[model samples]
Target: MPGTRTNPLRRLLVGRVQGVLNNRASGETPVVRSAHALYPPDSVIWRVHGDVTTMMIGGVTALLLQMLHPAALAGVWDHSTFRSDMLGRLRRTARFIAVTTYGERAAAEAAIEKVRSVHLGVNGVLPDGTPYAASDPKLLAWVHVCEVIGFLDAWIRYGERGMSLADQDTYVAQAGLVATALGCDPVPQTRAEAEALVAAFRPALTANARTREVARMVLTQPAPSLGFAPVQRMLMHAAVDLMPPWAKDLHGLHPSAIEVPVVRAGTMAIAQSLQWAFAGRATPRD
Candidate 1:
């Protein structure tokens, strides 16, 4: 058997995975094994954000959850290319996570600042005449919490089977460092608090035409290439299966009882295959 680096099997698996996650040209690549990264290599965030498959599923879940909030949805609706190029939107977000989680301190901080700057311009009136801004502290907090929780939830479901509450809290705290820098106040320090915050935000999260339309695009968007479509479908189903019951219902999405197990099992098989491909590579590409 060839080494992981030169193995055709490894390259093929890793290539296909990257082709989907790195779907668009973002002009930035994640710095692998940087000794000067913001988080240590052994940190919980690195582990949670490192798995490409679960991160994809979690990311979809996060987007769906985030869009339920009118402000978050408004920001994307008014400023983002989500309607025309959903894959580009996904790539930009995935790149941001990759850089912040795996990039060096300067790069991570730069990514944060870029996003903050962009948020300053992303304000608009909601469909109900409510004013909304992406830079609002509470709204930012909502997005942050949804993302971190979604990622952690996916990791527990597919990547790591038995992560403890304490570790999960650690993951939230570690991930919150970026949120704090971005000026999001009241970031949650624990999974319980995060869940509480989600419930608290419920009064503000609404399901409407815009929300349902975005959800449809998220669920039905085409993958970058035909061969990757199956992987994309599997990830979308798993993400839906991973969503909280309330959020799923808000989006008027139904769970396929029969496909749930199949989706999970298929994702597990894909994840394990990628794990094997990157088994001994010094820097596993997520």
Candidate 2:
């Protein structure tokens, strides 16, 4: 009540109601409901939904800026930190996917090594282990290319922000080379071909239930407990806050809405499960 004197009762009431409405809207709205239907009701759904929503809102904001103040937006895009953060996030996510999906630790290590072997290869380091050699520029290029492919997949499949026809082609070209370098074939040209490729890889994944379980666990974890969540949140907030005021007004996405602590918790649990499946004891803390 003391603080309420300055805040004003009317404004407080309105803010509280808006918060409730937003929460309900996020959960039960058509888009979110459709997302839940598309993804089995699981932690993966929550994580993906949150990510796509954030990206969509962010993309819209960027598009608005491009329309209203193209020069300003271009400047922001050209900022070194923006590129560094994006590359770092992609590299980290790619390593996680590679390690979990392949279930071949040595191959993952080798792939990272190959990326580092190239010139101008920054942001190609493994998340869990120290690099065996100095980062190679070529290796960094390969990693970034692979990440572009992954990002495109997420964008297309999940409706993430900022994906254009041009971006898709760029991803395809980069991914093709990266795949070839890794002795993996390029992604199929068509969606059908992609499906076939996925099916072909399905057996390997299924054969090792442990890997699938680990991936599932990671997918379900909440953000706060994840090693990367804090950093990710900070970046997300900064990106959102940097958008023009009108863009923020249009989207009405408060930064707090994107916060997901559960993701980290789920990842930790899954990591522990992976250890057990691999004949190792769960960590004492787990």
Candidate 3:
């Protein structure tokens, strides 16, 4: 009889991959015994957000779109250290989403309070010397809407399954709660409302030197490691593909006709790979 034995290199590789995929070193653990959760277990938001691939791509899309708003971009330019620590910024954002969506009610509220405190300290003069405050409801609304819309768009385009009309609306409404918590007003309660809000606000968005530079940074930022480059590039292109035409044009981020199919295929492949890798890991919150 052959002895049952596992290759040492195979075991080492499996451990390394698991560590990367499930590491909580930065304190982003989902609370298994929280008294309350932001959304219910069976909610559509949980389903859409649970996928790491779509959420990561959606986050890039959100940041790109959010920069189109001068005030929002100005706020970041004046205060954020994104240039020096892009990965840190991404980790922070991912942590916020994780704790808020999956952590207990108390933890989520604490995270919101911490963010509000940070916003109170983030104020500066724009390039035109127009004063800007992160606490402004209007600016907050713009950021919130861009992020929510991006997440929904990515999930819809690249999700494992199609979300129904009602579920889409539910996702928007559910997400609106987080926006409201962050001091955003006129939070869209449905898909139609969200779309209308985006249309109404388009005139206020623009591309400028700063916006273009930031867009470039988002696309060309160095990956955390060499092995991560190809995946990062794929995610960036996927983000561009998911972006609206006007927004993409604003950033001069046109994917060539030949590149479009490649982007779509790569995005789907990445999304599917992530789904397979993380299966049964993130249990839907109850």
Candidate 4:
């Protein structure tokens, strides 16, 4: 009886996994058509972004980091429906990154234009009556730097171990193209420059009531499916662990020292499972 059930259960699991991996790509018009890929097969951006587990987890970390900026938080607060539509927010971001990094030049430019059109309508007043605009070059730069750095940091910590310094810089520079397209100015092309940009923005970053609420939502949101709940918890823990110490302090998160190793081990286990599940699958450029 156990043998009889094993194959069916395995098929069900694999089907669910395939659906997730195919998100936004299984459409009649895929966001990243293979022939139109901008990044070559061996490009650093492709390698860094191909890991689904790390990228999604890194996205959560990036969201928290980006919200630290008052203007950025105001944009989301006034314009985004993320409180009720977190998955939509995540999917749009994932699609943008996926398309820009792998889609043909024309398609990528189209995606950027779509985002810019949306940004044009997102300007509003903050709680203190200070004005904020999603398209503001300064705010765009903050969001872009936080996101790319978060991705690179996640890849380095969990996905790849021995990337050369040059390759790291290449990934940053390559990611900057999308940022520049979205109207962020002075995109950093090197690790040092990116780090300096982050440092410069630190003085303007703080955790406020809204930031804490968003962090709570990200960490505690129910998994989309019951089967993925355990994996999601592990991933969230890993994301929190990957955050800067100052960020942790800002959010009032004190992940127990003892829990760090446990979270890392669990996250790695999940990431490896994904790698195996996706074995022989197409890379981003493919």
The candidate scoring highest on TM-score is: 1
Candidate 1 residues lying further than 4 Å off, grouped into runs, are 23-27, 281-286
lDDT of each: 0.85, 0.34, 0.78, 0.80
Model 4's alpha-carbon lDDT is 0.80
lDDT, model 1, position 124: 90
For candidate 1, lDDT tens digit of each residue in 100-174?
888878998999999999988888997779898888999999999999889999999988999999999999999
Better of 1 and 4 by lDDT: 1
Q: Would you estimate the TM-scores of all the predictions? A: 0.95, 0.28, 0.89, 0.90
Candidate 4 lDDT tens digits, 1-286: 2332255654464455444434544452444435567677678888888887889788988988898888898888778888897766776787788788777878888889999999899998877788888888888988998988889988888889787889989998988888888899879999989999999999988887888998888789877778878878898998889889998898998799899999988888878766655444443222
Clashing pairs in 1: none
- Residue-level lDDT of model 3, residues 50-140, one tens digit each, is 8777887899999998998888998888789999977778767876777787778888899999999999999988777788899998888
Candidate 4 has which clashing residue pairs, if any?
none
Over 4 Å off in model 3, which ranges? 1-35, 283-286
Which candidate, 1 or 4, has the higher TM-score?
A: 1
Let me know the TM-score candidate 2 reaches against the reference structure: 0.28
